[model samples]
Target: MTIDMNTLDKAILNRIQTRFPLTSRPFATIADELGSTEKEVLTRVSRLKDAGIIRRIGGNFVPGKVGFVSTLCAAQVPEEKLDLFARTVNTFPGVTHNYLRENAFNVWFTFISPSMTIIRDNLAAIAEKTGVRRILNLPATHVFKIKAKFDL
Candidate 1:
Protein backbone atom coordinates (compact mmCIF):
# COMPACT_ATOMS: atom_id res chain seq x y z
CA MET A 1 0.00 0.00 0.00
CA THR A 2 1.98 2.92 -1.31
CA ILE A 3 0.63 6.27 -0.08
CA ASP A 4 1.55 9.47 -1.88
CA MET A 5 1.92 12.14 0.80
CA ASN A 6 2.77 15.80 0.43
CA THR A 7 5.23 17.95 2.38
CA LEU A 8 2.57 18.98 4.87
CA ASP A 9 1.62 15.36 5.42
CA LYS A 10 5.23 14.42 5.95
CA ALA A 11 5.69 17.30 8.36
CA ILE A 12 2.57 16.32 10.23
CA LEU A 13 3.72 12.71 10.58
CA ASN A 14 7.20 13.73 11.67
CA ARG A 15 5.94 16.24 14.17
CA ILE A 16 3.29 14.07 15.77
CA GLN A 17 5.25 10.83 15.96
CA THR A 18 7.47 12.06 18.78
CA ARG A 19 6.45 15.28 20.52
CA PHE A 20 2.71 15.61 20.12
CA PRO A 21 1.43 18.79 21.63
CA LEU A 22 0.16 18.58 25.21
CA THR A 23 -2.50 21.19 24.60
CA SER A 24 -6.25 21.30 24.24
CA ARG A 25 -5.91 22.17 20.55
CA PRO A 26 -3.04 19.91 19.60
CA PHE A 27 -3.76 20.13 15.89
CA ALA A 28 -3.81 23.88 16.07
CA THR A 29 -0.51 23.88 17.94
CA ILE A 30 0.98 21.59 15.31
CA ALA A 31 -0.36 23.83 12.57
CA ASP A 32 1.18 26.86 14.26
CA GLU A 33 4.55 25.17 14.34
CA LEU A 34 4.30 23.96 10.73
CA GLY A 35 2.87 27.22 9.42
CA SER A 36 -0.38 25.50 8.46
CA THR A 37 -3.94 26.11 9.53
CA GLU A 38 -5.79 24.03 12.08
CA LYS A 39 -8.46 23.03 9.58
CA GLU A 40 -5.88 22.04 6.97
CA VAL A 41 -3.93 19.98 9.49
CA LEU A 42 -7.07 18.23 10.68
CA THR A 43 -8.14 17.48 7.12
CA ARG A 44 -4.71 16.13 6.21
CA VAL A 45 -4.57 14.00 9.33
CA SER A 46 -8.01 12.57 8.57
CA ARG A 47 -6.95 11.76 5.01
CA LEU A 48 -3.77 10.07 6.21
CA LYS A 49 -5.70 8.01 8.75
CA ASP A 50 -8.28 6.96 6.11
CA ALA A 51 -5.41 5.92 3.83
CA GLY A 52 -3.92 3.78 6.66
CA ILE A 53 -0.74 5.83 6.87
CA ILE A 54 -1.51 6.49 10.51
CA ARG A 55 -2.75 3.65 12.68
CA ARG A 56 -3.63 5.74 15.76
CA ILE A 57 -2.74 8.91 17.60
CA GLY A 58 -2.56 8.82 21.38
CA GLY A 59 -0.32 9.15 24.40
CA ASN A 60 2.12 6.44 25.45
CA PHE A 61 2.57 5.89 29.15
CA VAL A 62 4.57 3.68 31.48
CA PRO A 63 2.19 0.98 32.69
CA GLY A 64 3.89 0.47 36.02
CA LYS A 65 4.00 4.19 36.74
CA VAL A 66 0.27 4.28 36.15
CA GLY A 67 -0.40 1.37 38.52
CA PHE A 68 -0.64 -1.21 35.76
CA VAL A 69 1.15 -4.48 35.05
CA SER A 70 2.25 -5.71 31.64
CA THR A 71 3.47 -8.99 30.19
CA LEU A 72 4.64 -10.50 26.93
CA CYS A 73 2.45 -13.37 25.73
CA ALA A 74 2.92 -15.99 23.03
CA ALA A 75 0.66 -18.74 21.70
CA GLN A 76 1.26 -21.62 19.31
CA VAL A 77 -1.67 -21.05 17.03
CA PRO A 78 -2.07 -23.28 14.02
CA GLU A 79 -1.87 -21.41 10.76
CA GLU A 80 -5.50 -22.29 10.03
CA LYS A 81 -6.60 -20.65 13.30
CA LEU A 82 -4.17 -17.72 13.40
CA ASP A 83 -6.71 -15.14 12.28
CA LEU A 84 -9.30 -16.28 14.80
CA PHE A 85 -6.74 -16.39 17.60
CA ALA A 86 -5.50 -12.91 16.83
CA ARG A 87 -9.04 -11.56 16.62
CA THR A 88 -9.94 -13.14 19.94
CA VAL A 89 -6.88 -11.75 21.71
CA ASN A 90 -7.55 -8.31 20.28
CA THR A 91 -11.02 -8.30 21.79
CA PHE A 92 -9.39 -7.89 25.21
CA PRO A 93 -8.85 -4.24 26.15
CA GLY A 94 -5.54 -5.04 27.82
CA VAL A 95 -3.96 -6.13 24.56
CA THR A 96 -1.74 -3.23 23.51
CA HIS A 97 0.20 -4.85 20.70
CA ASN A 98 -0.33 -8.02 18.67
CA TYR A 99 1.60 -9.50 15.78
CA LEU A 100 2.63 -12.75 14.10
CA ARG A 101 6.12 -14.23 14.06
CA GLU A 102 7.67 -17.18 12.18
CA ASN A 103 8.24 -19.30 15.28
CA ALA A 104 6.68 -22.25 17.06
CA PHE A 105 4.73 -19.82 19.25
CA ASN A 106 3.75 -17.57 16.38
CA VAL A 107 1.08 -15.29 17.77
CA TRP A 108 2.56 -12.75 20.19
CA PHE A 109 1.12 -9.74 22.01
CA THR A 110 1.67 -7.35 24.87
CA PHE A 111 -0.99 -7.29 27.56
CA ILE A 112 -1.30 -4.66 30.27
CA SER A 113 -3.70 -4.53 33.19
CA PRO A 114 -4.00 -3.45 36.80
CA SER A 115 -2.74 -6.83 38.04
CA MET A 116 -1.21 -10.11 36.95
CA THR A 117 -4.36 -11.89 38.06
CA ILE A 118 -6.40 -10.02 35.48
CA ILE A 119 -3.83 -10.77 32.79
CA ARG A 120 -3.85 -14.45 33.71
CA ASP A 121 -7.63 -14.60 33.65
CA ASN A 122 -7.72 -12.90 30.26
CA LEU A 123 -5.14 -15.34 28.92
CA ALA A 124 -7.22 -18.24 30.11
CA ALA A 125 -10.26 -16.73 28.46
CA ILE A 126 -8.34 -16.24 25.22
CA ALA A 127 -7.27 -19.90 25.23
CA GLU A 128 -10.82 -21.05 25.95
CA LYS A 129 -12.15 -18.93 23.11
CA THR A 130 -9.49 -19.76 20.55
CA GLY A 131 -8.78 -23.40 21.48
CA VAL A 132 -5.08 -22.53 21.51
CA ARG A 133 -4.09 -23.86 24.89
CA ARG A 134 -0.31 -23.52 24.86
CA ILE A 135 -0.14 -19.83 25.67
CA LEU A 136 2.97 -18.52 27.45
CA ASN A 137 2.82 -15.46 29.67
CA LEU A 138 6.27 -13.98 30.28
CA PRO A 139 6.33 -11.08 32.67
CA ALA A 140 9.33 -8.79 32.56
CA THR A 141 11.63 -8.57 35.59
CA HIS A 142 13.56 -5.59 34.26
CA VAL A 143 12.14 -2.68 32.30
CA PHE A 144 13.64 -1.08 29.23
CA LYS A 145 12.22 1.98 27.53
CA ILE A 146 13.23 3.18 24.10
CA LYS A 147 12.07 6.01 21.90
CA ALA A 148 10.83 4.96 18.47
CA LYS A 149 10.36 7.70 15.92
CA PHE A 150 10.33 7.59 12.13
CA ASP A 151 11.81 10.42 10.05
CA LEU A 152 8.88 10.42 7.64
Candidate 2:
Protein backbone atom coordinates (compact mmCIF):
# COMPACT_ATOMS: atom_id res chain seq x y z
CA MET A 1 0.00 0.00 0.00
CA THR A 2 1.65 3.20 -1.14
CA ILE A 3 0.59 6.48 0.40
CA ASP A 4 1.06 9.85 -1.24
CA MET A 5 3.12 12.28 0.87
CA ASN A 6 3.78 15.92 0.07
CA THR A 7 6.93 17.88 0.95
CA LEU A 8 5.48 19.14 4.23
CA ASP A 9 4.36 15.65 5.18
CA LYS A 10 7.83 14.28 4.57
CA ALA A 11 9.39 17.13 6.51
CA ILE A 12 7.05 16.53 9.44
CA LEU A 13 7.95 12.84 9.47
CA ASN A 14 11.68 13.52 9.26
CA ARG A 15 11.58 16.11 12.03
CA ILE A 16 9.49 14.03 14.41
CA GLN A 17 11.45 10.81 13.83
CA THR A 18 14.10 12.42 16.04
CA ARG A 19 14.59 15.69 17.94
CA PHE A 20 10.91 16.08 18.67
CA PRO A 21 10.37 19.21 20.68
CA LEU A 22 10.18 18.90 24.44
CA THR A 23 7.60 21.62 24.89
CA SER A 24 3.94 22.21 25.47
CA ARG A 25 3.35 22.94 21.78
CA PRO A 26 5.51 20.39 20.03
CA PHE A 27 3.59 20.53 16.79
CA ALA A 28 3.81 24.28 16.80
CA THR A 29 7.56 23.98 17.19
CA ILE A 30 7.67 21.58 14.28
CA ALA A 31 5.52 23.93 12.27
CA ASP A 32 7.83 26.82 12.97
CA GLU A 33 10.82 24.78 11.92
CA LEU A 34 9.10 23.67 8.75
CA GLY A 35 7.70 27.15 8.04
CA SER A 36 4.12 25.97 8.47
CA THR A 37 1.31 26.63 10.92
CA GLU A 38 0.48 24.46 13.93
CA LYS A 39 -2.91 23.64 12.44
CA GLU A 40 -1.31 22.54 9.18
CA VAL A 41 1.30 20.44 10.97
CA LEU A 42 -1.32 18.80 13.15
CA THR A 43 -3.51 18.08 10.15
CA ARG A 44 -0.66 16.53 8.23
CA VAL A 45 0.43 14.47 11.21
CA SER A 46 -3.08 13.23 11.76
CA ARG A 47 -3.40 12.26 8.11
CA LEU A 48 -0.07 10.42 8.22
CA LYS A 49 -1.10 8.55 11.37
CA ASP A 50 -4.47 7.67 9.92
CA ALA A 51 -2.76 6.32 6.78
CA GLY A 52 -0.59 4.05 9.00
CA ILE A 53 2.67 5.70 8.10
CA ILE A 54 3.32 6.18 11.81
CA ARG A 55 2.58 3.24 14.08
CA ARG A 56 3.12 5.18 17.30
CA ILE A 57 4.61 8.39 18.63
CA GLY A 58 6.19 8.04 22.05
CA GLY A 59 9.37 7.81 24.01
CA ASN A 60 11.61 4.76 24.37
CA PHE A 61 13.18 4.22 27.75
CA VAL A 62 15.76 1.91 29.27
CA PRO A 63 13.67 -0.47 31.36
CA GLY A 64 16.41 -1.16 33.94
CA LYS A 65 17.18 2.50 34.38
CA VAL A 66 13.51 3.16 35.05
CA GLY A 67 13.17 0.43 37.72
CA PHE A 68 11.76 -2.05 35.22
CA VAL A 69 12.94 -5.37 33.83
CA SER A 70 12.77 -6.63 30.26
CA THR A 71 13.18 -9.96 28.54
CA LEU A 72 13.13 -11.45 25.07
CA CYS A 73 10.50 -14.17 24.69
CA ALA A 74 10.06 -16.64 21.86
CA ALA A 75 7.22 -19.08 21.27
CA GLN A 76 6.60 -21.87 18.81
CA VAL A 77 3.10 -21.09 17.58
CA PRO A 78 1.37 -23.29 15.05
CA GLU A 79 0.45 -21.50 11.85
CA GLU A 80 -3.22 -22.16 12.42
CA LYS A 81 -3.09 -20.42 15.84
CA LEU A 82 -0.85 -17.52 14.90
CA ASP A 83 -3.58 -14.88 15.11
CA LEU A 84 -4.91 -16.21 18.39
CA PHE A 85 -1.46 -16.39 19.92
CA ALA A 86 -0.47 -12.93 18.74
CA ARG A 87 -3.71 -11.39 19.97
CA THR A 88 -3.37 -13.04 23.39
CA VAL A 89 0.21 -11.86 23.71
CA ASN A 90 -0.63 -8.29 22.68
CA THR A 91 -3.36 -8.05 25.30
CA PHE A 92 -0.64 -7.81 27.96
CA PRO A 93 0.39 -4.19 28.54
CA GLY A 94 3.99 -5.16 29.22
CA VAL A 95 4.44 -6.63 25.78
CA THR A 96 6.19 -3.92 23.79
CA HIS A 97 6.06 -5.60 20.39
CA ASN A 98 5.91 -9.01 18.73
CA TYR A 99 6.67 -10.30 15.24
CA LEU A 100 6.56 -13.53 13.27
CA ARG A 101 9.89 -15.14 12.38
CA GLU A 102 10.73 -17.84 9.86
CA ASN A 103 12.01 -20.31 12.46
CA ALA A 104 10.95 -22.97 14.92
CA PHE A 105 10.35 -20.29 17.53
CA ASN A 106 8.17 -18.45 15.10
CA VAL A 107 6.63 -15.78 17.32
CA TRP A 108 9.05 -13.52 19.24
CA PHE A 109 8.40 -10.47 21.42
CA THR A 110 9.87 -8.22 24.05
CA PHE A 111 8.20 -7.82 27.42
CA ILE A 112 8.88 -5.35 30.20
CA SER A 113 7.70 -5.17 33.77
CA PRO A 114 8.71 -4.13 37.25
CA SER A 115 10.14 -7.57 38.06
CA MET A 116 11.03 -10.92 36.57
CA THR A 117 8.35 -12.62 38.64
CA ILE A 118 5.64 -10.53 37.00
CA ILE A 119 7.04 -11.27 33.56
CA ARG A 120 7.14 -14.99 34.36
CA ASP A 121 3.57 -14.91 35.63
CA ASN A 122 2.44 -13.14 32.47
CA LEU A 123 4.30 -15.69 30.35
CA ALA A 124 2.57 -18.49 32.21
CA ALA A 125 -0.76 -16.81 31.63
CA ILE A 126 0.03 -16.45 27.93
CA ALA A 127 0.98 -20.13 27.66
CA GLU A 128 -2.21 -21.21 29.39
CA LYS A 129 -4.37 -18.90 27.32
CA THR A 130 -2.84 -19.75 23.94
CA GLY A 131 -1.88 -23.37 24.73
CA VAL A 132 1.55 -22.77 23.20
CA ARG A 133 3.77 -24.08 25.97
CA ARG A 134 7.16 -23.89 24.31
CA ILE A 135 7.87 -20.28 25.28
CA LEU A 136 11.42 -19.18 26.10
CA ASN A 137 12.26 -16.18 28.26
CA LEU A 138 15.77 -14.84 27.79
CA PRO A 139 16.67 -11.89 30.01
CA ALA A 140 19.57 -9.70 29.03
CA THR A 141 22.50 -9.40 31.38
CA HIS A 142 23.72 -6.35 29.50
CA VAL A 143 21.92 -3.91 27.28
CA PHE A 144 23.08 -2.12 24.14
CA LYS A 145 21.15 0.99 23.19
CA ILE A 146 21.25 2.28 19.65
CA LYS A 147 19.75 5.20 17.74
CA ALA A 148 16.99 4.16 15.30
CA LYS A 149 16.14 7.24 13.28
CA PHE A 150 14.93 6.92 9.70
CA ASP A 151 15.86 9.53 7.09
CA LEU A 152 12.52 10.02 5.46
TM-score per candidate, in order?
0.92, 0.90
List per-prediction Cα lDDT, in the order shown. 0.92, 0.92
Summarize candidate 2's per-residue lDDT along 22-119 as a digit string, tens digits: 99999999999999999999998888888888877888889999999999999999999999999999999888889999999999999999999999
lDDT of 2 at 142: 95
- lDDT (10s digit) by residue, model 1, range 1-152: 56789899999999999878899999999999999999999999999998888978988878999999989999999999998998899899978878899999998999989999999999999999989999999997777989888997
Error of 2 at 115 (Å): 0.4
Count of steric clashes across candidates, in order? 0, 0
Alpha-carbon RMSD of each model: 1.5, 1.6
